[model samples]
Target: MSEPGSDHDAPQAGREPIFMLPPVVTALAGIMLAIHLATTLVLDNVGLYQLTLWFGFIPMRLLAPDQLPGGFWPLLWTPFSHAFLHANWEHVIFNTLWLAIFATPVARRYGALPTLVIFLVTSAAGALAFAATTLPNVQVLIGASGGVAGLTGAAMRFIFQPVMVGTDPDTGQRVLLGRHLASLREVFTNPRSRNFSLIWIVLNAAVPLVPALIGQDIQIAWQAHLGGFVIGLLLPPLFERSWQHE
Candidate 1:
């Protein structure tokens, strides 16, 4: 009953359109921003430090044998809690802006459930990477930047390897290849996407370096950023490929 090429068009038509700044992500961003502001203003310095100790991911300190509490709830909750805490106003504002920007796009593409999963997983990965590399007693690390970085990484995958419907020209039949890669030819030929991607890498990579050059003792947690970005870039292919087969 249907035309040969109709199947190809069906997927495009059936796609749930993405709305800008999905409610869940917006709410999350607002809540996180509010918490950071409240913590900075209402809470005393000692209270803030205690909050960070409980919520922040301190790598080896939390994961070490002696430090592990005799409880499961702390382990399960730390990942989410770490995201809510921040070192300072500047730290929270920077991370919150990027989280809103990158996360909105990812939430729109993957829907609320998957987007939340990605955020938690990638944030964990970022923290894990930090913990593995840094000394246990150095300093407390807090913020959503790691998770936000993961969303950016994930977005790269969705944007680059799009799901498409193509027609078999000979038979005029439509086929869906839920996973597609941009051509190598396009990498050199397409300046816009290439430049944009390059710029993102440069800016994020530079974030840590700037403070170092200024002779500041600020630890940038470059490890988390790199970890999140790698996870973002790599996970999409594996996730989508598995989905396609299923």
Candidate 2:
């Protein structure tokens, strides 16, 4: 039988083991950060504005295909393209850090291909939520935060699962078998994990509310975050069987 965590079936010989980041996720985050920085520096406000107009996914405005130049492709691609645009350095930096931290573990757990699929699916869901809730005339919805939020939600699912324990037949020693949802619930219900989850929820829920409380026009896109998180939370059980088979 193959080792549980082994990447391939090759014999454990003299060859150096491959040590590499998950390719699809690393590439996606790197490319997004690069584009955000490059565009911020290269384009003037007017140019940047125009770029956002063309590439950003604004659900309400996007409903009218005739308003945009490229039409259907823009709508399809916008789900990904919006992830490359940002309001400013602070926005990109925060989102990039979050993506790097949360997504790496998920990519490692699920492998690069499944990670990418989850990201795209959750991102599209986030965008659709944003479009559905807001006014139709809103010009552009930009940033990778939605996708990152999805990754966060997915991470929560991956982390919060049950574990199996058994006893050795001969030695009569306890052994941890594997993790599953029941074990996760036990962990989460404990004070530490429950506190952490509460803190996370409070902070994210406050993100949009704080801006509004300050009487600022800046929108935090909380709806997208919530949408992505819910989708990710629900997706794990559906995908779990296949993931275990892999």
Candidate 3:
């Protein structure tokens, strides 16, 4: 039987096995960082403002689609496009770092095309979830947090298993997916998985309250994080066939 992540699980009988970041994963992270720099450093305040207005996911627009500036057509792109933009250097940097960790495994297992698909779908799902919970004219949601959260969810599919030095009966050596991959029950029952889930939930749950303690009026898109994470957790199984061959 084929195991998930088998493609990257073991090295072939080659001269040497070199470990490195897959090119596509690196490229995706590079593109996000490059865009952040270009928008923050190169673009003028007015230019950057305009881009945000155009690209940012505004829940109000969904309520009043006819009132959107530059026509309602921009709505078509904003859902996924907003992920490519960030509010500040810290926001972009943090998300990019997470992407490197989670997306690398996915890209290695499923290839570049599927990784891109995951980014788009999770980004949009997160935005939609944010819109669903928020009232109109609240605030615009920006950043790759949702997409990265989705990646985190995807990684949870098999990354938490016990590791082995050599081939073990339960899980082979260096195999993240393990012998049979994890069922939802195995995932939730595992201590590491349970703790991570709790921590993630608490962190997102506290997003709105955290800003208040600092006397800031920021609206954190916690809804998006939850949405993306749920999608990530559930999406991997459906796409299992794509990576099973690896």
Candidate 4:
């Protein structure tokens, strides 16, 4: 379609394009950025901190409720709610770009509701990972990194498969088709996807060690990233099966 008089017809025209994010992905990204903007512009330092106190997932809040704020309700929601909050414009913007890239494909395949479920599930899984690593210590974990990482892992199930490009003998037209979702064994055996996952894990593992190397601590929730990725990697097959049954 980009070329004049090209015989190529879009096979899965609905498939996510490189530059254009699906509507659901765009909307979720908008919500994340909007929340960050609202917190930054509308709330004072005290208010912002208070709101984060209520919304952000602090593992310590579970151990010593009086040391922090809120009651059972806050504990119940913060695990998932923290995914909607971000540390700064840079943080949200980074996640927004990744959402545009990775979540678009997931939204295209799974639709809005399933995509939302995946995000929420992965976000909660991330919180669990964060809590596992930092108990008793009051560390605030906020941002869509976990959910985004989950989406990224989910994308790995098929995105690396080779796209079939061929000319139809009858119509003399070129066609492209989407790839099949690979099983776990296939995922580890495929070099491109295996390498991609390795790089992702290695990068996240390196985050905590940065402070040790440079003596400047960064507030990255690497644990959440890994936890979300684990769930997301294994979760897509269920979605594919669900779609088949539906």
- For TM-score, the strongest prediction is 4
Q: Among these predicted structures, which one has the highest lDDT?
A: 4
Model 2 lDDT tens row, 62-112: 567766667656787887778778888888888877888878877766777
Cα lDDT over the full model 4: 0.86
Candidate 4 clashes: the total is: 0
Give the TM-score comparing model 3 with the true structure, all chains together. Answer: 0.81
Q: For candidate 2, which ten residues in a row score worst on lDDT?
A: 178-187
Clashing pairs in 4: none
Instruction: Decide which is better by TM-score, 3 or 4.
Output: 4
| Between candidates 1 and 2, the TM-score winner | 2
Candidate 4 residue 177 Cα shift, in angstroms, is 5.8
Residues 1-246 of candidate 1 have per-residue lDDT tens digits of 666659877887778857457877877787788998888789897887777767777665554635543333455566667887777778887887787777776665556776777777888888877777776565566788778888887776545555689897899999875435444345334575467667767776787678668877656777777777767765554445435554
Q: Single out the weakest 10-residue window by summed lDDT for candidate 3.
A: 10-19
Model 4 CA deviation exceeding 4 Å by range: 1-19, 163-177, 242-246
What lDDT does each candidate get?
0.70, 0.72, 0.80, 0.86
**How do the candidates rank by TM-score, highest first?**
4, 3, 2, 1
In the range 92-175, model 3's lDDT, one tens digit per residue, is 888888898998877766778877878888999999999888876557888888888888787777678665333546755554
- Per-model tally of clashing residue pairs: 0, 8, 1, 0
Q: Which portions of model 3 show Cα errors greater than 4 Å?
A: 1-19, 162-179, 212-214
